[model samples]
Target chain A: MIRPGSTLGILGGGQLGRMMAMAAADLGLRTHIYAPERNSPAFDVAAEHTVAAYEDEAALVRFAKAVDVVTYEFENVPAATAAILGAHAPLAPNAHALAVSQDRLMEKTFVAELGIATAPFAAVAGETDLVGALERIGRPAVLKTRRFGYDGKGQVMIRPDTDPAEAFAAIGRAPAILEGFVPFEREVSVVAARTAAGAFAAYDLCANEHRHHILATTRIPAGVSRGTEEAAFEIARSIAEALDYVGVLAVELFLLTGEDGERLVVNEIAPRVHNSGHWTLGGAVTSQFEQHVRAICGWPLGATGRLGRVEMQNLIGDDAHAWEQVLAEPGAHLHLYGKAEARPGRKMGHVTRVYPESD
Target chain B: MIRPGSTLGILGGGQLGRMMAMAAADLGLRTHIYAPERNSPAFDVAAEHTVAAYEDEAALVRFAKAVDVVTYEFENVPAATAAILGAHAPLAPNAHALAVSQDRLMEKTFVAELGIATAPFAAVAGETDLVGALERIGRPAVLKTRRFGYDGKGQVMIRPDTDPAEAFAAIGRAPAILEGFVPFEREVSVVAARTAAGAFAAYDLCANEHRHHILATTRIPAGVSRGTEEAAFEIARSIAEALDYVGVLAVELFLLTGEDGERLVVNEIAPRVHNSGHWTLGGAVTSQFEQHVRAICGWPLGATGRLGRVEMQNLIGDDAHAWEQVLAEPGAHLHLYGKAEARPGRKMGHVTRVYPESD
Candidate 1:
């Protein structure tokens, strides 16, 4: 068993990895970060770091062997890398999860097969497939690449007048998935964790807002009915169980309101910590970062009790320039990733404001 | 000005430095920990680290020049080291504060000169000085070395009929001070932060329990009268202002109950974060670590609001073997130092528990 003094190897040296390393340190676990970037934010906090490409088999094996267990900050970890790591040490959330979440076609299929509600999606392998899928899925649909897509990248919208060929061309016709747009009244997510022993816990459903297809703000006590919140938890639980997941996961969902009342459909599945869950750092009894560490460490999960009404806003690009003002605001917890440069849409840091429940 | 992305250099590499580096990381500040030990705990979380002796002036100058501001984790930092760092980069809680705190006699004299109540004390340099000071201070006193004493080391208690020469010999007759012991109801501490800008904030008075001269437990709300609590804060503020101090400082005081009600006498002052303040990590709106970083950065002080009734217990030595049980306990925040071995009386870790105010 990996005890407090044992080392944990984390792949992907981004803000998520940085926060994860700090959390692991809090629990007395040493962290070794593996990333190809020299100034990776995670490297600053980890006890050890390997600046090697993910495809470097020798480096991957060395990193895995050096730590008692291995985890990752991003779900885009390649299948072969997971296999190499798994061969050396325990990999949390499993290789199967990476395979499923790495491809939109596989993720939608997995969720649909598990009887979970997801957007109507059809695989589009080429221009011919895109034309056929767009016909069936209808206009005003999203044509997204099956793999290697994030932050509004590798995806384009197809409207009624827009050419299907142009849409496919826009995405470079890369094994796409055409998902019919759902008129979601609100975007919310269930961030939860599951252990190998089948134990599971979920944070309260959170309402999320996106700006320019990038996560902007997340508020707890998502303005959904109690029944809808419970249903969201159920959806997350089913997904975790199907993946046999260990560590924190996020399931983004669309809350559709119609004559039939409120309904939830899975929009996306993040096999690692999600941006929406950042509020838990100061708003929840056990931060999601710490929760993920505990789960992957095979320790008892901490209480997911919310401390108060909370809101977390990501400081994207120039947004972080307001750090001074935010720091001056009392009760506002600010977290910066220690990134040297702040390019447009880059997540430089985040600010979380927590108010008494009465507020 | 030291801004969010600025690098902060720390003078020590123990657990206090480890926690401070983590805090600095949280606020977007990078930390470079300078310590002599190879496997210092602070290095695990710091952005950079240098293993060099305190007397290595070249290394100190290089470290100072590499960072925007410098603070330390312990008070016993050599005056020359502080001067070197300050000459290169801004150093908080100036060298004078360090010089006074590094010596028992200087600290008492400084506090006494500021009109603060302290145990009756007299300087002892030799056998003649010890005997004469013993006569002036009376029996039942503590003889502590003027420098480099901690955790009950370098001190011997003088009881009635005890030979003063033996007591002096026991301490190697080093430059020392004889302090008349005060019969106190309890020991409490005031952990506060002060900025060079003259802003000050103090957490609630915390009653501390010592085992083997080491802090074993700290319970906040000290159970002292409102007046005594305010008085304690006043004493801490006066000391900070007198030193033109910056960063977090702890004032250990003896709480005595008598016909005049509760009274506080200064026992010692730590120029950096103290163990008794660890409870603030989870029990206050802003932790002492973050507060220290903020103050030293010349930022606005944060709210010192307490969350509730809080208790923190140090996991000393083999006591950390209960990590499993502690992890299983709900609402308990466990913090472990990444030390490989847990020697006797070593602070291996700590667990903080916060209950509803009513509790």
Candidate 2:
């Protein structure tokens, strides 16, 4: 077992890593953040930091040797980097999780093989394959690159009037997956944590709304049927057990309203703490960041009980400029990532508001 | 008003300051910690730090100039230190608060003058004053130095047979106060915060138990009558308004049983966050640390609502060695100060356990 005072090495020095480091510190564990960028926000709050490329084998070896366990903030951790670190220390959410989540085709197949509901998808390796896959998946499908996609990036929509080859070329003709569009009623996610001992705890289902391909708001008690919520949790548990996951993972699903009331179709799996789980920081007994730390450290999972009715809003781009106004509002917990610039479409911070339930 | 991007200067580099700095970062503010010790625990988590003597005018000036506002972790701030910083930037909790709380005689007089009840106290400046005060206050009183006392230090008990001169000399014959002991049932504290606008909010009353004069455990709901709790809050409010206090302040009081039921008498006032308030970190809607940052920054006070029944236990000396066991316990929130050594009587960390109220 990883003991207190042991250092946990984290890859990627963004706000996610910064929050993870803080959670680790609260558990009496030290954090070492490794990133190539100078002024990485995580470095400011960590016990130690190394500015080096992920491909730098020597630096990776030294970082792994210095820490008791290793985890990463993003799913796109290069396979070679995971191998190097795993050789020296325990790597949580393991390399298999990274491999499956990194590729759109593999992720869909893995979820489908588990007898879980997923949008119909086909692989596209070339223009011919794109045409064939487009025919199989039908119009209004999404052509996403097999690797390096996030926040609606590395993908193009294929509508009835749009050309299949053009859509594939837009993604640089990389090996991709064509997922048939699902006109769903709403998007919901199951943010959960799993320990190596196979213990699992999931937060309540949360409804998510997106604006301009970016998450704008999240509300808990998603208004789905009890059956749908239970099914969502079961899907998450199966995914975690299959991956042998040992950290917080989020499963975004499309809640389709049918004759049966509500049906959930798996959308994607995030291997690390997700933006959708930010509400847990103040609205739940234990935050997803802290849950991730506990799992990675091989500790018992904390209580996932919700505090009250919760709503979380993201402060994207210029939205964070009104931080002073937010701070003045009572009952609103405003959190800002220490980023120097307010570039468009950037996630600068978030605000969570929790209300008491009616008696 | 202090803006979100502004810097917050913190005095006294201990766990309270460390948690306060973390809360400042959460609200989009940067922190600069100033302390005399070379390895101050707070420095590891702060954006900037100054290692200098509290009496170092040059360093204090530079620190004050660098930050937009200043606050301290403890009440024993030197008058000259406050003056130096106040000249350069806004200092929350103000200078008068420091002056009043630093000296036990002044604090008691101020509380007593406000029509609030306090343990009968007399100023003892020398052997003559000690003898005169002891004769009047009688035996079973505490002889405390007027300034710079904490955790039962700088105070000696005057029993029935102890010589007054010896007790006075033991405290170095410093200007002191002889406080008439109250036959109290329990010790309780009100951790409250006030803004410059005169807005005040207090957390629920907490009952404290000490081992060897150091805090061992703190339980919320205090097991006190509602009337007693209300009176305790009124005392704290009057004190804050009297001193024009801003930021979090703690008022320790004795819960004495009267024929009418429970009554409270003022014990002492802490100008900054107190150990009794540590439970707020994970068991309240807004932690005392965050409340202090919000008040100092001119932001609205957050909700002081408790999450559930909570118990906070301090990990002193070798007690911190059980950190791993604590981490493995479900629902236990462990907070370590990153102190390098576990010297006897030193506070190394704390654990807070919160239980849901039974319906």
Candidate 3:
């Protein structure tokens, strides 16, 4: 088991990695951030950093050998990279979890196989497959590249007027999955953690809002029924247990309200801390970042109790320029990622507001 | 004015500096730590670090030039070191605050001059001065070196039978002070902050307990009367205003309960983030460390509302070895300074437990 003084090696160097490094430091652990970017924000707060690409086998081997254990901020860690690191040190959430979550088709298949509800999806390996899948799933489906898709990128919405061949060509003819639109009433997620010893813990369900395919805000008490919330957690626990996951993972679910009652469909699984969980930073007894560190270190999980009614809004791009105003507001907690450029759609920081639960 | 993304130069790379650096980074600021020790705990978290003596003029100038502003974690920053840094960059709390707090005689006189209650004190520069001061202050006093005394070092107890001369020699006959000890009921502190605009905010008064001359635990509500708490805040405000202080300052006070009422006597001032305020890390709406950064950067002070009934316990030496047990305790927040060894009496970590306030 990794002790408090052991070194924790992180794979990515973005805001998530930065927060994780800070959490690890709070537990008296040293951090070594490994990223390909020269000016990765995580490097500023880490004790050590290596600016090397994930594909660089020599650098990856050296990094693995230097730390007691390794974890990544992003789920799309290359299988070869995970293999190399796992050979040298423990790589958690484990390689299987990454492989399962990396591809949309595989992720959906895995969820469906667990007797959980998931959006109807089919593999589209070629143009013929796209047409065949489209005929079966109908129009208004989203054709997404099976791998390396994020933030509304690498995907196209198929409409009645849109040509299947044109849509396939738009995505560079990559292997893809066509998901039938679920028309969800609300987008909610479960951010949870599991230890190697099978100890599982989940935060309260949070409702998420997205703008331009980017997550904008997350609010707790997702306003779902108690049974629906429990169902979501069970889905997450089962998925984690299936993968033998040993870190924080997030499951985004669509809440569909019908004539009967509320229903939930699994959208996707993030094999790492998700932006939707940012509310836990100050709104819960234990933050998701800290929980991740504890689980990966083979330690006991912490309390998942909520502190108050919470809302977390992302400070995107130029929105961060209003930080002075935000700082002036009483009881508003502001967190900014140290990124110099304010390119539109880029995440610059975030603000979390927690109100006392009214009696 | 210094802004987020600006580099904050910090001196004395101890746990206080480490926490301050982490808080600064949360606000999007980078930190550069300068300390004489190569393995200083703060070095692990800062963006840049210089392992050079505080008296190294060239290194001090370089560090000052490399950052937007300068602050120190300890009160005993040498006059020359402050001067050099001030010439190159703005120094928060200013040099006068440091000079006054560094010497016991000056600190007591300053408080007394402000029409505040203080222990009866007399300056003792030599053997004759010590005898004269002892005669005036009476026995059962504390004879302490005027400067560089901390953690019960450079101070001796003067009992009725104890020889004043012998006590002076035991303190190395350094420039000293003789203070008539007060029979106080409890030790309390006001951890507050002041901005350049003269805006000030104070956390709730906290009662502290010490073991072997080191802080052991701090609890909020202080068990003091409302009037006494107000008086402590007034005392702290007067001192901060008098010094033109900008940044966090902790005023240690003694709360005395008498037949008439409760009275407060000023003990000393710490012109930096203090151990007594550690409870605020998770116990208050905004932590003392974050408040210090805001004050120094010419930003508005954050809210200081208490989250609950809070208690912070320091883990000294081998006490930190029980971290696994603490982690297992739900809702307990643990913070460990990245210290390798558990040497006797050294602060290794801390645990904070916050209970919801009863209606």
Q: Which candidate is the best by TM-score?
A: 3
List per-prediction Cα lDDT, in the order shown: 0.93, 0.91, 0.95
State the displacement of the C-alpha of residue A176, model 3, in Å, after optimal TM-score superposition. 0.6
Residue B52 error, candidate 1, Å: 1.1
Question: DockQ numbers for every candidate?
Answer: 0.83, 0.57, 0.89
- The TM-score of candidate 2 is 0.96
For residues A14-102, what per-residue lDDT tens digits would candidate 1 score against the true structure? 99999999999999999999999998999889999999999999999999999999999998999999999999999997999999999
Docking class of 3: high
Q: First chain TM-score in every candidate?
A: 0.99, 0.99, 0.99
Ranking by TM-score: 3, 1, 2
Residue range B19-100, candidate 3, lDDT tens digits = 9999999999999999999889998888999999999999999999999999999999999999999999999989999999
iRMSD in angstroms, per model: 0.8, 1.8, 0.5
Model 1: per-residue lDDT, tens digit, B287-341? 9999999999888888889888999999999999999999999999999989999
What is model 2's interface RMSD? 1.8
Candidate 2, pairs of clashing residues: none
RMSD value for candidate 2: 1.9
DockQ of 1: 0.83
